[model samples]
Target: MTSSLRYWKKNNLTYVLHIPPHPIPKSPQASPSKTHVPLRPVSPLQNRTDIVVDHTKWGKILGRIGSESIHIPKVLSKADVHTLTAYIAYLTSSGHPREVKELLWALFPELNTSKYPSNSEEHSHRALGRKGLLTTYRRAIFLGPVFLSAVLNALYKSNQPILADRIWTLAKKAERLSWARKLLPNVKPWIMGPHAYTVMINCYSSLARRQYWRMVLRPQRLNYRTAIASVWGTLRYKCQILPRPLPSHQVMELMHDLMRHAALVVFRRFMNLRHDYAEIPEMRRWLAEKDIPKPDARFFNAALRAFRPRTPPMRKSWYRRQLRDAKFNLDFKGVLPNSNDGWNGSLHEVAKNMIHAGFPLPPGLQPLFVGRLRGFDLPVVHGPDRGPFAYRPQKIHPWLRYRLHTPKEKGLPVSRAYPQFREVLAQRRRHRRSRKRQRNRRAEQDAQRVAPKVLSL
Candidate 1:
C-alpha cells in the first residue's frame, strides 16, 4: 500500500524532487570567434593606380585651362564705361543709329584716332558702323524708346543726315503716332523729326479726302458703297501717277497732288453738264454771258462745316434745299387736282412729275420706294374701336404698337405658362380628367351602399 501510494504520488502528484549542490561556473576569457574573424586586405589593380594618376593630371590640366580661359583683362576706362552706357541709352530711347554714332563721337573723340586718318567720307561711314554696334548693345541691355531717342539726337548732331532720316523714319513707323508726336518737338531741336511732320500732314490729308468723298458721293443711310467706289477710284489714279516704293517724306506730297487732280476732274465733269444745255438760244445766250453767282456766306459756312476742323451746328435744311435746286431737269405737269380729290392724288401727281423729269429710280434704292408703297396699304389701328382707317402717313405698324403698349404684368403668368401656355392648358385638362374619374368612382360606391343586396340560399 505504501509502494502503491508512493507510485501514485510520483505519477499522479508529479513531485518536484530536490538535487544536490553543484559548483558555480566561471566566465571564459574574451577571444575572436571564427564567425567574426577580420578579412585580409584586397590589392587594387595596377592599371587602376595609373588610371587614377592620369585622372589627377587631367583634373589639374583642366583646372589650369578653366582658370586661364575665365580671366578677362579690364581694358575699359571709367569714362569709356559711362560713354558706352549713355550711348546705349540714347540708341534705345531715340531708335536712331545716327544719333548713337554722334553721341559716341561726342563722348569718345579719340575712338577715331589712328596713325593714318581716313578720309572724311570714310570716317563718317566708319562712325555709322560704330553706331550700328550700339544695336548689339541695345539687344544686350534691352534698352527701350527713351534711350533710343537720345542716341538718335546725338547721331543727327554729328551731321549724319541720311542715317538720321532713315532712323527717324523707322522709329516713326514703328512707334504709335501719338507717342511719336509727343516726343517730336522735344527731340526736334536735336534731331530732324520730319517723320512726325509727315504723319500730321498725312492725317489731315486723309480727313480732307474723307470729307471730299462724302460731299461728292452723298452716301445716304450709312451705305458706304458709293464712298468706297470713289475712294478706290481716287486711290487707283493716285497709284498710277505716283506708284509704290515712295519714301515716307513723299507720300504726303503725292496725296495732295492726287486730291487736286480729283477736284479738277469733278469740276470738269460739272462744266460738261452745263455745256449740254447750250442748244437753246436763250440757254446759249445765258451760257455766253451770265454773271456767275458769287458764293454767299451760307455757301462758305457750309463748306467750312463740311471740312469740320471744329465742331459746329449743321444747317441741314439749307444743304437739303441746295441738293434739291441742283437738279438740272424739270418736268411741268398741269393736272389740276379737284377739291374733292384726296391728298393721295396730289402725292401721285408729284411722283409722276418726278418720273417724267428724267429722274430714274436709283438701282438698289428702288426697293425702299417699293416698301413705302406697300406700307401705305396697311391698315392702321389707333385704339380698340377707332382703328383700321385712322392711318397717319408716318404712323408705325400694329405689331410695333402692341409691342410698345402692352403692360408687363398682363402679358403672361409666371411658371410653365410663360414658356409654353399651350402645355399648361394641356396639363390642366389632364388634371380635370383625373378628378372626373375619382368622382365617378365615388358615385358608384355610393350607389352600391344605397341599393339593397339579396342573400343567396
Candidate 2:
C-alpha cells in the first residue's frame, strides 16, 4: 500500500509539472500554393546524412590544434587525408583502440577516392616567424604515405587482414606510379619500414590463426590454412621493399624475438591457438629467406617447446612459456623417453637443433646428432644489461593474461594470432577497389539517365 502511494505521488507530480504546451496563434492568411518539381527517387541504400563536427568539439578531441571545424566534404582532399591520419595516430597511440577502429571505418568510404579537388592539390601560403622569416608549407599539415599505411595498420588492428592487404598492394602501386611518372625525381620512393614488414608478417599469422581457431570450434571443415601460410613464405619475394636494417645489438635482439615468434607460427601452423603441427625446418628457411637473426639459444629453445606435447589435463596455454624453464617448475625431463627409445623424422631433426641451441636437458635423454644438451638451467634472460632482452614472462597480463574485463584494461592483450598481437596490429586500410567499382557503376547509371534526358530535349 505504501509503495502504491509513492507511485501515485510520482505520477501526480509528473502530471502537474509536465503538461504539453499549446501551439502558438498564427496568421489566418493561407500561403501561396507551390508547384512540384520532378526529382530523382531516393534509394534505401543511399542515406546521405552529414553531421558537421564543430571546431570546439574536434579541437578537444584532437588536443589543442586551434579551432577547425570538421565536416564531410564531397571530394577526396589532402587536408581530409592528413587530418584523418593524424586523428588515427592519436587514437592508436592514446590507447583508444575502439575509437581508432570506429574512426577508421567511418573515414574509409570518405577517403577512398582517386580524385583530389583542383583547389586542394597545392596551396602556397606563408606564415611569419618571430624573426620575420617566412615559412611556405601546406597549412593543413599533410605528411603520410600516399597509400595511407596508417589506415592499413588500423584495419589490421581490427582484424581486417583482407582489407589491409588491399591497402598494402595500393601502396606498392602508388610507389611504382610515382617512380614511373617521375613525379618527384628528388624524393626517394616510399618504402615500408621494419615495423610494417613485421606487421604484415604478423597479419598473415593472424589470418592463419583465425581460420585455424574457427575450424576447431567449427561445425565442419575448411580450407585456406595453406593460403595464409604461403603469404608469409612469399613476403620476401619483393626484396626491394623488405627492410634490411643493420643488425646492431638492438637489431639482433629484435630479430631473435621475431625468430621465436616464427617458431610459434610453426607450433600452431597459423590456423589457431592450439597448434596444428610444429614445422621446424620451414622456420629456419623463413628466417634465412628474410636474412634476419640466425638460430640462437632462445630460438632453439622455442622450437623444442613447440614440440611439447599438448595432452589432456595440461593446457595449451600452460606451455606458452619455456616448459623447460625452471621459472614455472616445468622442466624438460618429463617429455623425453628413456635413452633406449626410438626417435624418428622431423622430431629427431628439431631435437638436434634444440640441443645445438644449448637447451638444457636431464640425465638419460637422447641428445641428437652434432649437439649436446647441458645438464643445467640456462640463464632466463639473454643479452647484456640493457639491450633487447627477455625477462620473466609475467601473467599479471600475459600468461595470455587478461585479468581485467572492463573498458579500462589491465596487462597485455591475450596471445592470439601472434605474440604482442596488439603491438603488431596497428591502423587501418580499406576495401577501396570494391568501393571505387561501386562508385563507377553508379556514375555509369547516371550517365545513361542523362543521355535519355538529352535525347528527349
Best by TM-score: 2
Number of backbone collisions per candidate, in order? 19, 16
Q: Tell me model 1's lDDT, rounded to 2 decimals.
A: 0.36
* Stretches of candidate 1 exceeding 4 Å from the true structure: 1-120, 127-130, 133-168, 172-314, 325-457
**What TM-score does candidate 1 get on C-alpha atoms?**
0.17
Give per-residue CA lDDT, model 2, range 309-337, as digits (tens): 32233344443332333222324334442
Q: Which stretches of candidate 2 lie over 4 Å from their true place?
A: 1-84, 93-149, 172-183, 211-457
Q: After TM-score superposition, what is the CA distance of residue 236 in candidate 1 from its true location, in Å?
A: 28
Tens digits of per-residue lDDT for model 1, 133-201: 343333313323444454455554454533443344344333332222333323221111322222222
